[model samples]
Target: MKRCFTALIALTGAALPSASGQGHSALVQLQAHHSQADLEHMEEHAHYRYVGELLFYSSSFLVEEGGVERAATEQEVLGIDLHAHDGLRMVDQRIAVHDPLIDKHIILLSRNEFGALVLERLSPLDRDAFLANKRATMEQPSSKTQ
Candidate 1:
C-alpha cells in the first residue's frame, strides 16, 4: 500500500476487501496508510478530495435486496435503483436516514471470520466508534509510507 498527498486527495492505491468478507489485509500489512489523523491533518490543510476512504472502517452502508439480506460487492450493488420501497428490492448508498438528511455512504473495509478483507458498510454508531479509534491512533502516527 502507498499513499501520495496530492493537492486534495491522497492517492491511496487501495481497493476493495477480500472475497471472504474480511478487512483490508493490504492496508493492515502496509507500514503506512491514510490514518484518520492524516485525514484530519489534511482537512486542516483544507484537502477535501474524497473523504470516503477516511471512513473505510465505518460500517456506513446497509444492503438488503429481494427480502434477502446479504453482503455484496460494490460492483454487484452498482447501478441498482434505491428508492424502490414496495415489492421492489434495490441497492443504493444515499439511503434516507432518521436525520431527515441524505446519509452519505462510505465503503467499510472489514474482516470476516476468516480474516479476509471484505467490503461492507458500517452503521452510524460503528462509524462513530471507528472515528474514535482513528483519533486515538493519530496520537502516534506512522511515517513508514511504503
Candidate 2:
C-alpha cells in the first residue's frame, strides 16, 4: 500500500503541468521560430520599409442568445483584439540593402499562447491606396513604347 501510494504521487507530479494547463512553453518556442522565418522572408524580398511595435491578444467567448427554456443558442467565437498592452516589446531590424523594393511597410506583432510573441508582415496602405499604387505603376510608360 505504501509503495502504491508513493507511485501515484510521483505520477501525479509528472502530470501536474498538463493537468493544470500550464504547459505552453512548447507553443512559445514554435512562435519564435515562425517569427524568425517571417523576418528572413521579408529581408530576402526587399520589403524592409517600415518598422513599428505591436501588441495583440486573442480570446474565446461563449455567446448565448435567448433563455434556456426557449432553446438557448450558444457558440464560441475566437476573437483577436489588438491593444497597447504593457510589457509588450518588439525587436525590428532591416536587412542591408542599397535600394529597398518597397516604399512603405507595416509589421504586426502578437502573442501566442500565454506569453509567446510573434511578428507578422502587414501592408501599411489601405485598399484605396493599394489600388491607386497598382494603377499608377501599371500606367507608367516603359522605355520601349507599346
Which numbered prediction scores highest in lDDT against the true structure?
Answer: 1
**On a 0 to 100 scale, what is the lDDT of residue 118 in model 2?**
16
lDDT of 2 by residue, 28-142 (tens): 2223434755544433332211111111211111112231111101110011112222234333421111112221121232223212221122233322343454456678845
> Which ten contiguous residues of candidate 2 have the minimum total lDDT?
69-78
In candidate 2, the residue pairs with backbone N, CA or C atoms under 3 Å apart (3 or more residues apart, or in different chains) clash, namely none
Indicate the TM-score of model 1: 0.23
Highest TM-score: give the candidate number: 1
Mark the 10 consecutive residues where model 1 has the least summed lDDT.
Answer: 110-119
Q: What is the Å distance of residue 14 in model 2 from its true position?
A: 50
- Candidate 1 residue 6 Cα shift, in angstroms, is 18
Query: Model 2: what TM-score?
Result: 0.16
